[model samples]
Target: MSWRTARRICRPTARRRRKAQWRKAVDAVAGGIERASAC
Candidate 1:
């Protein structure tokens, strides 16, 4: 595949992985808050 084609495929996948990681972090923080409030 050409360089352009490789970049197009890889860029979105990287972005998606980054977004998933961010969401996971946010969820963890929210869970922590909930637990703290419950105690």
Candidate 2:
């Protein structure tokens, strides 16, 4: 595949992975806060 085609495919996958990682981080923080508040 051409460089342009490769970039187009890889860019979205990278973005999706980054988004998933961010969501996981947010969820972990939220969980921690909830646990702390419950105490």
Candidate 3:
């Protein structure tokens, strides 16, 4: 298969992984901010 085909096949999985990481990072930052604000 060509690189374009491979990329198309992998794109969704990569996007999901990235979204999970982004959500985790955002949640962590939000949690930290909440704690800091509570003080």
Candidate 4:
């Protein structure tokens, strides 16, 4: 397969994985802040 075609196929899932990772990181930080405030 050509390089451009392979990249196009892989791009969407990679983007989605990065987005999910970012969301998880944000949630963890928010949870940590809430716990700190509660203590």
For model 3, how does the per-residue alpha-carbon lDDT over 1-39 read when each residue is reduced to its tens digit?
599999999999999999999999999999999999999
Please report how far candidate 2 places residue 33 from its true position, in Å.
0.3
How many steric overlaps are in each model, in order?
0, 0, 0, 0
Local accuracy of candidate 2 as per-residue lDDT tens digits, 1-39: 599999998999899999999999999999999999999
Runs of candidate 3 exceeding 4 Å displacement: none
lDDT (CA) for every model shown? 0.98, 0.97, 0.98, 0.99
How far residue 14's Cα lies from its native spot in candidate 4, in Å, is 0.2
- Worst ten-residue run, lDDT, model 1? 1-10
- Residues 14-39, model 4: lDDT tens digits: 99999999999999999999999999
For model 4, the stretches where C-alpha displacement exceeds 4 angstroms are: none
Misplaced by over 4 Å in model 1 are 1-5
Better-scoring candidate (TM-score), 2 or 4: 4
lDDT of 1 by residue, 2-38 (tens): 9999999899999999999999999999999999999
- Collision pairs in model 2: none
TM-score of each: 0.75, 0.78, 0.92, 0.87
lDDT of 2 at 32: 98
On a 0 to 100 scale, what is the lDDT of residue 36 in model 1?
100
Q: Which pairs clash in the backbone of model 1?
A: none
Evaluate model 4: give its TM-score: 0.87
Best by TM-score: 3
